[model samples]
Target: MKKIFFTLLFFGCCFLISAQTEPKVGDELIIEAQDGPTYHHIKFPKLNILVKRGKVANYKSVHGNVVIIDDVITDKDNNTYVVLKKKDGSKFFGYLTKVKANYEKSIASGEMVVKS
Candidate 1:
């Protein structure tokens, strides 16, 4: 019985990992409003820079913005990065290249909803 339980747990963990969504270039997504003050790993540039540039770099302000996946980059360390841009043909407030994990987490948390 213990063997069976252990086997099931192992497979379940694998399934959960496999279920994580991966972002691709040119994917159209919309920013969904998140609760609380957390950005869910969606880190923007410094707050000072945002203020200096006359922009509010918070999740609430970014909610409902159309996000275009501009590029997918893999670094020498095998770390993956995603470039995000605005749909209106302009750069989003600041250059935010999300790490693969953070990008996937945002998707999983419904903070970044893929447009149909």
Candidate 2:
């Protein structure tokens, strides 16, 4: 029983790691939104964008080998914006509006200004 459990756990961990999408910096992706249906040309590994009622499907574009591990994004006064920082050191601020197919609508408003 112990051997079987260990083997299953190992395989499960391997499968999870393999299933992860490897996106590099400077890669551009054409993302199709599911609900509220908005098309966006997203550049990665730019910033981690939380799409409204949409799942991210990776598109084809340029690939870069540069790996960015720094997630710190601060302004002139040193204020952190989002969880993931803009990879290009640019600023972004807008109100994100989302509408679900089940007729459930949601909106998020905030301000973010990235500093050089």
Candidate 3:
């Protein structure tokens, strides 16, 4: 009886630790830039400077790896936005308008891999 109880307790502790370590969609992650100067410039048309890999930028277009915190949000004018948080503690407001499409694309491309 004592051995059985101890075994179950050990397993329970392991389970809890594993669960806490799992990555979720909203979790911040480090994403390496996969594009060149032209790609960054064209993608982030508003930004004038070339974005370097591993450097966090304000615009989502500068990154292929990003985290969409939640679902699509609509404003009074029907403008949509997606919440994106970077690994460097920087948050993008109104990051992307086409939330559903972008989210699907990210998942399909394996850019956003939430570890189980």
Candidate 4:
């Protein structure tokens, strides 16, 4: 009984950990570019480009890269803006477009498919 309990517990933990999704604000993430102008460009140490939600911007990491759903805050006129702050303390803003995820190859040989 004890052996069976322990085995089930271990597998349960593994399943939960694997199911947890990544990609959060302030997390060092690596996303592969599926399709875009900046395809194959490894954007390292990528941070959240858009501060607010519902915007579009480029998001990259050493292990992964992609142009993800950006939630950038916009003005009253609904013009979106992005703040790209580099590690060197330099900052800039630019317009971005929302792109569909084409391909996502994980750093660990797994795949993620996100559909709206």
Best by TM-score: 1
Candidate 1 per-residue lDDT over residues 23-55, each given as its tens digit: 688888887887866565556565677777887
What TM-scores do the predictions have?
Answer: 0.59, 0.22, 0.31, 0.29
Q: In candidate 4, what are the lDDT values of residues 1-116, reduced to their tens digit?
A: 99999999999999998665433322223343445434332222223545453334444331232234333334586433322222222222333223222222232333222322
User: TM-score for model 4?
Assistant: 0.29
Residue 42 of candidate 2: its Cα lDDT? 23
Order of the predicted models by lDDT, top scorer first: 1, 3, 4, 2
Question: In model 4, which regions exceed 4 Å deviation?
Answer: 22-96, 102-116
Once superposed on the true structure, which residue ranges of model 1 sit more than 4 Å away at CA?
1-20, 74-80, 94-101
Candidate 2 global CA lDDT score: 0.30
Cα distance off (Å), candidate 1, residue 29: 1.2
lDDT of 3 by residue, 1-116 (tens): 99999999999999997686433456543333433332221123233332333334444443544444544545696543344554434433334232232333444444444433
Compute the lDDT of residue 38 as modeled in candidate 3. 26
Say which candidate scores most in lDDT.
1
lDDT of each: 0.68, 0.30, 0.44, 0.36
Per-residue lDDT tens digits for candidate 2, residues 30-109, read 21222322312222222235343242433221122122223323458643322322344433222222111110010011
